[model samples]
Target: MQRGKKKIKEWKLKDEDTRRQFEVKVQQKNNRNRGGWKQLSENVLEAAKEVCGESTGHRRRRRETWWWNEAVQRSLQEKKRAYKRWQRTQNEEYKREYKEKTRQAKREVARAKRLALENWSEELNSSEKQKEMFRIAKQMKRESKDVMGAKYIKDERGVIKINTEEILGRYVTLKTC
Candidate 1:
């Protein structure tokens, strides 16, 4: 499928008529075929209207997930409302309160997400395949692999063994290889 929106009459013919021989013939043929101007203009207008309709039409629904539940959304909305309220009043107290609420709400959301991941990890710890997947996920979610001190690595000898290291070299190798 095409990446962006398609527009009518957007096919710009080659400028300066590179085909010197066929240019005059093409222009003459185009001029002679002028009877369809009324219908052509109407079609172009219709197309323009269609494009406008798409822009002004009912908004398309977004894909949502159960993970983005009501409580978090409500907290976010409340934070925004607090900020807006501060904006309206320009009161220092309101601004401070908004900042505090925002930090609290954000921390709450992050804590919830971390707790969910921990719960999932606990459940998946039973299976070897799941443990591997969890490890991969942990690696992917980490800000830096430098924090992975004395990490386990699958060696060239195909031995699942522990190897101690200060840093894990780089995540690029882990992702690519």
Candidate 2:
């Protein structure tokens, strides 16, 4: 069975022509297949693919915004409401209110972020939180690294290391040096 069976665009089946095409394809394949369940299953999958498109499985990466809180949400909502009101009326008073709300929202978000970072730093300072500290450090490192950049590990000759063995050798050589 194909891994992305669920990824098939089922909405295409809503169209009558598409449904007819799928049914015809399945019927044509069925007449040729004398084999049991396996052949029928394969024919159905092939029909589905030809009728509806499949997703490539690539998805967008969502960033972790751990600092977001209730205050930020409320401020952002107020800003959005003000902005809509200003857009609807084009009045100077409403525009000014929208600007003020935008600024307030920004301030709240910044404050929340600062507080979160401070809390993380405090946790890192505590001996008991060593495991949590390392986990956070690893997550931060993973987030900060450029996906398209070359590997950071280098040999003693200053050549960038690529392979796992070479990278390990570079680390071992560094410890000795």
Candidate 3:
């Protein structure tokens, strides 16, 4: 037996209708095998050129050259310099305002403290009892001494040292006249 089926004979068209049908089938097959629109357009153009003729001088122009202008660059530099100057002025103004605000606050606090001391002095001097109480409080502070981690009474030549414990405790003593 022949190794391969002896190269199958090519089909020959016998009529115009058969030839037209064969061409239609080939075109459909070609369309199915084609890619997207760009590829299809390229294939169609190539086929058109084969059937018709090719055109010339259909090329795109080169793009224009671009460079930075000296004047524009200088203007940009000036704008940046002006911005820095304005920023410096604004920062100085902010610092000045902050200092003035802090100075005002300090002045208010000093005035309030002075007025409070004046009122307290007036209250302390208003009544004789208040004055006596203040004197007694001062005397008590001068005489008190810590003894054995507690305040106690001590006598020196009949002078009594009275503290919290001695003042609060009750005592009884007998005397003959």
Candidate 4:
């Protein structure tokens, strides 16, 4: 169970000692008081936490921004410093500097993204990267199928035929045609 998203623990049921300790704690709770289902469940969870350990329930994720280099980092840092200076002093010059820095950082980030995409496209055009391109295409196709689920017939005005009678009428017209 999650509590404030700070810690998450699961029962170490595979370990014999953990299982025994959990059982003992649960039994002690059950004997100490005759409580409602909520109390009982809370006790069980407490016992499990004592036996098990907490986890953030996070896995390693791939970084999408492969083109994030030192230049982009420096630009962002400069922008942040300018913004902080402006915030602290509330000076017009500082504010202008912050705005300029923000624009420069945004341009840098956009340029990096464009360059990375171009490089990736170039690599994909090479014969050796054909397999990679096909793999990406297949993955995109699979994702599209998952997103665009259950295609339905639409009328000429582009409204979906929701009623059974309307669907049957459309089917009849199609068969006749």
Question: Whose lDDT is higher: candidate 1's or candidate 3's?
Answer: 1
Write down the lDDT of every candidate, Cα atoms only. Answer: 0.60, 0.85, 0.50, 0.80
lDDT of 2 by residue, 1-177 (tens): 234323666667865799999999999999988689999999998899889977665464333377988999999999999999999999999999999999999999999999998987787766866887788789999999878965578776778888999898888887888
Q: lDDT tens string, model 1, 22-118?
A: 3454455456555577855655445444333223222453343324656678888889999999999999999998998899788878876877677
> How do all the candidates rank in terms of TM-score, highest first?
4, 2, 1, 3
lDDT of 4 by residue, 1-177 (tens): 433443434535744787888899999988886799998998888777777755554454333356887889999999999999999999999999999999999999999989988987887877867887888899998988745565567776778998888988887888898
Better of 1 and 4 by TM-score: 4
The weakest ten consecutive residues by lDDT in model 2 span 1-10
Instruction: State the RMSD for candidate 3.
Output: 44.1
Report the number of the highest-TM-score candidate. 4
Using lDDT as the measure, which candidate wins?
2
Of models 3 and 4, which has the larger lDDT?
Answer: 4
C-alpha TM-score for every candidate: 0.36, 0.44, 0.24, 0.46
Model 3 residue 131 CA deviation in Å = 6.8
**If the candidates were sorted by their lDDT against the true structure, best first, what order would they fall in?**
2, 4, 1, 3
lDDT of 3 at 149: 60
For residues 1-177, could you state the per-residue lDDT of candidate 3 as single tens digits? 223322211222333464565556546546776787777666644444443333332344332212223444454455555556656786776555555555555555566567656655675766864876689799998789554463544443444547655434322111221
Which ten contiguous residues of candidate 4 have the minimum total lDDT?
A: 2-11
